[model samples]
Target: MGNGAKAQQRRERGGKDAGKGGKSQLKVNEASKSIVCGTCRQSFMTTARAPALTAHAEKHSKALADCFPDFKV
Candidate 1:
């Protein structure tokens, strides 16, 4: 087969399923952690990294405090 034809065959076959690896292929082994905001009573994915969660909390603090003082940080 020509190079073009070989390439077409490879494309048709598709590469190994990238999505079928690691945590994706299997179900989550452990329950996800939870984040409860003291000021807003909002719950977030505790599974997310601490830095990301901190950034998210920082962004929402102003709005949350304004809306619900009971839950504000």
Candidate 2:
């Protein structure tokens, strides 16, 4: 199967895009020690690195506030 099929399956199972691309959607998983992209369910192993995480967030058209509202970016 292709990636599209897998994505469809994830949608059917209500797994992917579960965060709706809003606040708290992008957060660090302490246990896993990774930054998870709630919009696409993609994970980054850089371990909550701000610059890397910010770069990824840009792909979702999200501003710094979406990732961290209290942050002074």
Candidate 3:
């Protein structure tokens, strides 16, 4: 098969295990306007904004980093 065909085939095969691991466990609480981390069960008020959610997620990421120095979230 040609290169383009091979690339298309790979895409059809889900690009070789694209989502095998490393999934986000963050969940949003619409009623309370907060985001909670599934791993740590930590919650923070989001005020229905992206920045707040991002900041809260970063906190969880930092906590994970403390445990695993090389871990990326």
Candidate 1's C-alpha runs over 4 A off are 1-33, 60-73
lDDT of 2 by residue, 1-73 (tens): 9999999888989966686766652354444644456677665564455777788779889964575443332
Q: Rank the candidates by lDDT, best first.
A: 2, 1, 3
What is the C-alpha local distance difference test score of each model?
A: 0.54, 0.64, 0.54
Candidate 2 at 38: error in angstroms?
0.9
Full ranking by TM-score: 2, 1, 3
Alpha-carbon error at 19 in model 2, in Å?
44
- The clash count for each model shown is 3, 0, 0
Clash-forming residue pairs, model 1: 39-71, 39-72, 40-71
Backbone clashes in model 3, listed as residue pairs: none
Candidate 1 — worst ten consecutive residues by lDDT sum?
25-34
Cand. 2 TM to true fold: 0.39
